[model samples]
Target: MRDLVAPALASLVCLAILIGLGVWQLERKAWKEALIDRIVARSRIDPPAPLPAFDAFDPARDEFERVRVHGRFLNDKETLVHGLAPGDTPGRALQGYYVITPLRLDDGRIVLVNRGFVPTELKEVARRAAGQVEGEATVTGMLRQSEVRAMFVPAPNPQTGEWFNRDVPGIAAAKGLATAGPSGVAPYLIEADQTPNPGGWPKGGQLRVDLPNNHLQYAFTWFGLALCLVGVFTAFALRRLRGETGNGETGENPASATATPPRP
Candidate 1:
């Protein structure tokens, strides 16, 4: 029994770690489900609402809220964000730039609007000339929070002014909207809806809600691995305990060592 202590302790420690991982994944599953539900519910909202006060905006409450705004597009100041979207034909994907154009609101305050995707070839404004809507316009879209740059995702390229994430503050500063009067620019962005553009180049309605809910599967995997670990440890402990007994797995009696094999 004394000899089994160290191995038993190690086995128990490993078992605890496996179980901890399983529990953590289960927690993640619940969190992911709640997040997905909130976003989906927002998408189904019937009528778009008015924009909130600049200072009143909160990421928690404001995100995914469908909003309507009366504005004029600052076409010349369009910033490109790298994106991929499904093309006219299914399955084949198109690499493009999501045209982040500033919309000067009726009251003079500005907000960044993701007009939609335009392929690399249409990058030159001249190529997709007609899509740029002139004069005042009414736009409806879902409010989106500025994307936080992840650890592994590369930062925007200063040389070419290329931005990958929907970083509202940085884009606003770059476009000189950071101090566009006292109101300046809204911190959040508006992902435009599928209302067609003039030339249909910068396609609208590109909001994608793809939150992968693999946490439940991950929890199952972790729990399954923990069970396997328990089974293996149980077998090891049984073998170790058997070895400690006088009649071990081989069933060779310890007394035979001294009895000299019956003088065969």
Candidate 2:
């Protein structure tokens, strides 16, 4: 009984930790499912709603919501962010850049628009000058939040005009639109629709809403690990009990027998 105390206590602590981790994964699974369902329903809405006022924008509540806005593109201020073409091509991934331009709204305010992908060769604005719209034009697309960079993602290099994420504030600041007073740029960006552009350089409708839902698998894996821990603990306890029983049946105390050794 004394020998089992420390091992049993350690096993119980390990089992509790495993179970806790499993439960946390299950919670994450539920959150991911709800997020998927919400986005799916939002994406299916026909004829996107009008773009909400800048003051009313909410990333969590309005992300993926289809909306339309009438604005003029600031072609000169367009920024290119690194990206890969969507779809599984047999060869290497088609490395490209997403053209993010500022759209000046009718109210004099500005908002960033992800005009979409352009091949690496056509990354220059002059290379696709025809696609640059002049004057006021109505743009329809999905509203997206400012991208949050992962820990592994390198920071944007403003000096070299290179960007890795759709950082609205950073881009606006770089373009000198951060302090545009009442016409300050919005916090979010608009992912342009599939409308064809002149010169066909900055292609639109590149929103990738198909988020992977592997949380359930992860949850199962955690739960399975917890079960394994329980099984191992049970086996160890059983073996210990069996050994003690055998020593008692043979009329030999394990500790006394070991300590006494062979008689001279």
Report the number of the highest-TM-score candidate. Answer: 1
Tell how far residue 83 is off in model 1, in angstroms.
2.0
TM-scores for all candidates: the values are: 0.87, 0.83
Q: In the order shown, what is each candidate's alpha-carbon RMSD?
A: 3.2, 4.6
Compute the lDDT for candidate 2.
0.83
Report the CA-based lDDT of candidate 1 relative to the real structure.
0.84
Report the C-alpha displacement of residue 168, candidate 1, in angstroms: 1.6
In candidate 1, position 171 carries an lDDT of 85
Q: 1-264 in candidate 1: lDDT tens per residue?
A: 686688778878887887888899899989988988898787667788888777678878878988889989999889998889898899988998999999999988998899999999998999998999999988988999889998977799745879998888888887767652348888788999998999997998888878888877887887888889788878767776666443544655767686546665
Write the residue-wise lDDT of candidate 2 on 209-229 in tens digits: 888878777768877887887
lDDT of the candidates, in the order given: 0.84, 0.83
Error of 1 at 4 (Å): 1.8
The number of the candidate with the highest lDDT is: 1
User: Which portions of model 2 miss their true places by more than 4 Å?
Assistant: 87-91, 178-182, 244-264
Which 10 consecutive positions of candidate 1 have the poorest summed lDDT? 243-252
